[model samples]
Target: MKKFSLFGLKFMFEVKRSSKNDVELYSTSYALREKIIYLILIMFIIAFSSKIGLLSKNNNYSVGDVVISDIYAPKTIVFNDKSAKEKIIENMIAQSGKEYIYSADAGRIYLETFDEFFDDIYALKNNKDSNVDFKNLEKDTGRRIPDTMVKDLLSLKVPEIMKLQKETRKFLENLYESGIIQEKATIKYRSPFDKKIEKLSNLQRQVVETFAAPNYIYDEDKTKKAIEEKVSQINDQYIEIKAGTLVAKKGEILNERRIKILESCGVYSYKKSLGIMMANLTYLFIISTLFYQIIFNRYKKDILRKSTYRSTVLIIIAFFLTFRFINNDLIYLMPADTALFLLVLLTNTKYGLMMISFMLFFLLPIIDYDLIFLVMNIASMTFGAYLIKKVNTRAALIAVGIQMAVLKVATFGLLSFFSEVETFGAALKSGEIIVSGLVSGMIAIALLPYFEKTFNILTLFKLLELGDLSHPLLKKLSMEAPGTFHHSMMVATLSENAAAAVGANAVFARVASYYHDIGKCKRPQFYVENQQNGENPHNRVSPFMSNLIITSHTKDGAEMAKQYQIPREIRNIMYEHQGTTFLAYFYNKAKALDPTVTKEEFRYSGPKPRSKESAIIMLADSIEAAVRSLDEKTPRAIEEMLRKIINSKIEDNQLSEADLTFKEIEIIIHTFVKSLISIHHVRIKYPGQK
Candidate 1:
């Protein structure tokens, strides 16, 4: 036995050369007709969404447009007159009186003034030493008192002066209590003792005048606050515009109010132009035709073979319907990136870009051709398609979404900056755009699994999940048929390397290879890879019976894949990997036993590999088994044997259906040989006999 390693998987058995070719690509007249039908259906969906309300005309009149007729509202409409309401509220507020809040210490100020006046008078009456001086008495009282009055008061007896002071204090206190003596108010007091004081000369009169002082202080702040509170109490008033009312007369320039009323009434006459409609339709037709041509010419093979084409159309229509029925400013929140992401995931980046273009061309009219919206959408789609090339994990998908959001925000910012609208409104619009981008990404990511499951499509994320060795079927295979499991792993490694070299889906190739031999688990003893004992099962059966058992694995694998709810692409590979090639040993054995046996009877029933990944897996599956079977494990011998196997497959028409050019095939062969050489390298021996 010879030992060899390929992509780090060690093998110690003779290689089994498979005679099956890669699956063939099929496109019949019915498939072509179906493509046409799907295209037409997609066109109708676009047209229906586009042409809705096409007959309704938009008013193009601005401020200068003269009203020819007295346009009235068709229905009773209650329009908000914001300006009028604001003006009314402002006027009411201006006319309203202010509220006044009295100071908490105002009473204390009055009390202090009264106390000072009484103390000065009482001190003068008693002839006691006091701080009140006659010369400065006017300053303290805020009024002038005669010098003669002070001299006369001091000359009087204590009892007479005391009685006069008591009477004066009582009169002043009464005046203060009357609320007439405000802190800033002037009071002229004519005392009841004025008649009596007339005999005492001008002294008493001067004292009375001096005693009268302003008591009430004006509070400017409090008064102003009161007025403000009154103003704030006024409510906004509305003006109703009645139906059948003349919003604007002929030759009357439209003011803001008149314009608002006219808009509210839905009053405007639009010129019906057939030429414009025809031009729009022509534009739609040209763009739609170009879109159809792009898909038909570029992705015809991928689309025609399955429901992917229909699914694409359906996805587009779903978006169209969303735009049609859900009328709102939030139409920007439509996950346009979702379509781009799906297109990139399902087909390629080129198709994704084309989808963005198609969506913009068709949806712009529906969105009223907003240039800012178009720019943002384009930026979002472009980044989403480019960034989400291969989403193997949910986290990677989220990261792609974040990238799209950042790009969208940047695009919106640029648009806002160039528009020269630097107001808060522009900032708010930018925020909305950013939010829409983020929401779009989330929706796209959230809907990815559903889309994959619904369309029976194999996304890279789905492939990763299926590729996990922990999966129930894979685990079962590993436990039940350990040798076969190892063989599948080796085949997957080879397929993945070849796929990457040829620029194919390496993940899909690897995942498909993993479950390709699952059917062998059903009859582990019959397959040589799983046979533990040296007894060959084929020795006990006829060549035809052995051939039947061998060929049935492909069918059985497909059935098991379906039972496990595996994706259609993987199931397809399982069915087509062995591509109706002759089982040489069994066919030859049968021919030796009976000369009339047909070659087809000993062949594996297969539809053949249809895609590049499937074809790569088919080659890898055969190559891995064959390389393992070789007795000569030298690098050069292995390379020569690999080339012979490839050449044999090509010569046998096994690679005919594979979409592989000669250049790509060469690269794949080189990659395979390099990987095998690394695995089969000769080890240095120390003092050992050859």
Candidate 2:
């Protein structure tokens, strides 16, 4: 008997090991499938973003081609011709003339000469020589004078000559100081002693003429610099092409101005089409590769599903097309934040931020590399995503929208402060940005339900809605199977605590647990929790039949969840909670009746718990049911029971597929023990107790 028991034990151990291996294999296959799906989705997005404009017939138009208006400008957009502006500015600079710079040194030279001449006059006057020499005066004055004129000057008294010299010096000083001594300046003088100005001798006229000199010197360097500075101060000139103006007629040849207008309106030339196509393809490849690398490194699990990645790609594509088709003036109102909001709702904040950044890069060329538009939209989208990240109510979206608008306005103002462009029409642009943010938020809020339904995504709002106990399915379960409902509530409590302790999704666990036992409502009388008045249904049914009834609950619950349109994640937990675990009581009874009965016959049909949340539900469900049946309700007994139940699941390899570490499992155990103690805690009876 001992040898036979050993053989049986070994056989059972092998079977359990094989079952664990199967779970691992299935998990690996599922993960591989998810990765493949994600790869295909990424490829599709890359192809879509890259080939968007390349395939269009209009993209083939060249500079020489005659084109008609397929689409008209929606408003009177006044586009500044960049090339024309550059040319106009250059012409303005070229036409500016050099300026003449005046110098004070010429005036100083004139004054010094007058003072020296006056000193000479005083020297001759104070000398008191018996005879004044006219020849010596002529030499000192540095001028040739006629002999007759010199003799005539000598004939005058010393006081008369001194007075004449003083008068001449004063006249020359005034002339130089007045800045009239230019290149063509001339000086004519008349002595106070001469009765007629025309009667003055040639020698006297020569003396006065020698003092007249050009004071102003031409400064080539200073003139050139002054002209350059004046030119630099002139603002850039632009050629404004008003909307509704015919840039080109049907047969008119396209000039540079018309070409600029066409380019501004998003018409491209086919002359460089190949180069443009290559550049766009290269950019798309680089961005797509980087995006994939980031997702693989940081958000592998979050975007592993096709639906999640596809939804994000679709949002980006939708926005891209919207911008492509809309009028340039209204481009700001394209609802950029809508993509970010959906991304946050679908994936997470980090992924949403990364995707939006990539989107900005893609939009740069399309928007004519407008940094203001790029920065404003990026800031608004980021703020919107952050504001709504933790919000769980639809009403909160309005507040987020308002806050996003305020943030966009502030962002626009800050950007405008640093902008080099004139702020003449900034009020209208600011209004546009504000409207864009507000309208974008409203649109996002309006379309959120549609996106959630279409993608079958479980956002925070959806999770909250599912958590409501008054939900139709939960209410039905409550009325049909009160015992199972109570059990579900207990499991939900346990799972929530354990999930929190292990740093898992607590709300997801709670909501999933609330609906995990809905299948029991179909036949509540068969379950032990719903058994009435000392009656056991298992007594009348065979173990095989009982196992079938028990095992069918997981499949039934999944179908019921589907009927109510529950999210796939929650339905998955319902289907995976049992995790191929055997109905131990029925299995034991069957083995007692017939020793040939196999443990596999009592096991639930399961692909095993494939996530932390599902695994947590599995553990909580078993613990709650086991603890409820314990007669000896003490802290020590409950702790021991919890350990044994956890150990059994571990040995059975039910949790092999879950991404839980040993440390997390230990934390879960501690949490479960504490919660069970509180639930089964003994209370002291007062004196008036029955």
Candidate 3:
């Protein structure tokens, strides 16, 4: 029977050990976890890219309608239906040689130079005595020389009048060269393009009513040769089109069909528009990188712990893709603040700044104009993040509301610069943006508890809050079982020191200390600390019952911790702080009475402390309780107590499963003994002290 029992116990022991191993094995499958995150990120990028048509090629064309006219007027003037040509000619005539036009009847006039005018009346005719004043004639003409005449004359576009002037100049030069009029000859015309031929007979110089080729003009043969010669130069000025493709027409609309062809030819369809968007995207990336480096990167681990890169990537992709359906407004929701708050609960200022920067990047392609609003959004998020960073309780939800207000005001201020918009409208948009941030932040806050429960990412800040001395359970322990509470507090001090010395979580140790004795509150009188009236309940109970009561704290504490939704990390410590060990004091007392009491019946069943902090607390609790019994609270007594406790725990195989090394244990023991002796040492008394 004994051999069969031993075999059965060994089998049960193996099963328990295997179960604990399984728990730890699955807790750290880091490689598979990271792969899953990356896969999700890629899927999100693809979805967003497709949504915005970012994967598809697009193009644009510029076109305008032009009219044909033969009047040879400036395009601007023709379009406006203004007589700019006549105005220009009139201005030119004012600055012409005095002899060019004399007395004019409506549009027709006689012309002569200043010298000719002088000679005909004052010099040659010698009518100077007859008041033939040239100055009077010039004043009577009412035409003044203008400063811009030369420029207007050069720019004049009357092709026919220009031809006439050339012909007249040729005729006069020929007349003088052939000695037809030996004296210097001069040609006259109503205007530069309307020359009056003097030597040609009326028949030869007939003014053709219809457009006609001048006799001196080139014939078809010569004209064709001249056209061919100019073709090369003209061709260079025209837009070249390949032989098979149709040339683009002016004012043509680039419909879908045309755009497709253009894209196929490696042409940029949107012309310059794509360049601007790409530039904005690039700028956004730069700004985001800078902001993230400065603000978000510092707290990267903490932020990413909750806001996984996979989720951020997915949200960014979703926001980017939304650009196809809409623009600026939608993109604003994708930035660092939104992503951080949505994906993670920590709304720190650093994260807010990073989120804003990221939002700017996402907004680049979506916000076609007015970048100031994006800046405002960023500022608001930064403020919100700062407000929520230090929130340790659920009331931190107020920070979210405050953040919304900041966003609204900042956004309104930014939008005000561009237009005198209605304050209500600005206020409304601001409110919307703020609300979004708050909603997202609230969601994050709600998830925080679940995340902590599922993942044992116990932060110090959270542990400190959980360990508050005034917490209901701790208060109960203090009031009902003050002895146990005081013992727990001493254990907390020793365990905290030991944990820190071993480079473990001291806060976890301290928190575990408070709740480690919580089970004693159920039967406070049975424990010595709460037996103030000196009625020892254990004296009347069987040794087995006493052991059951003492050991049941682990079970009771575990139940209470679960009921309160205490995190698994804290709960685990409570379960493991005191590994199954013999309660020798009560067991010895029972053994003296019956001499047959089983030691097994006097031991508390345990899970054994799994983590370094829990293990340290267990040792500290035992050592502190043992050292308190010393007649003299000396350094040697404390040191011996610590050594015995540690050695006993090791001998019982309690510390074997823990991660703490021998080196760390040694350090912990030294630090704990020193601290304990310091606390208990007697200070030198004054002169009268005995």
Candidate achieving the largest lDDT = 2
Q: Write the per-residue lDDT of candidate 2 for residues 466-555, one digit (tens) a residue.
A: 999999999999999999999999999999999988878898999999999899988899998888897988889998899999999988
Deviation from native of the Cα of residue 539 in model 2, angstroms: 0.4
lDDT of 2 at 491: 97
TM-score for each predicted model, relative to the true structure: 0.63, 0.73, 0.47
Give the per-residue lDDT digits (tens) of candidate 3, residues 1-690. 122356446422322333446555555344334443453344334332422432234323433212111111111100111234344444544543232112123211112232233233223233345543344434644443232432233344446335544554455334222222111233223332244344444422432111111212113455445444544333111121232344334445555434433333323335444664466555554554464454343644534454444444455565455554553334334333444454334233454455445544444444443465556655665656556545556556546645655665666666664554445555555666666555655655555555455554454345766788878888888888889999999999988888878878676788888888787778889877678667898889876678788888888888887787666677777778887777898788788888888877776677887788878888887888888788888887778777887898999888877898989999998988888887788888878756
Top candidate by TM-score: 2
lDDT of 1 by residue, 246-299 (tens): 566666767667776766654433332344456657777777777677766776
Q: Cα RMSD (Å) per model?
A: 20.4, 13.2, 18.9
**Is 2 or 3 the stronger prediction by TM-score?**
2
Task: Tell me the lDDT of candidate 1.
Answer: 0.70
Q: How far does residue 658 in candidate 1 sit from its true spot (Å)? A: 1.9
Error of 1 at 531 (Å): 0.9
User: Which RMSD does model 1 reach against the true structure?
Assistant: 20.4
Off by over 4 Å in 2: 1-174, 180-209, 216-304, 422-424, 687-690
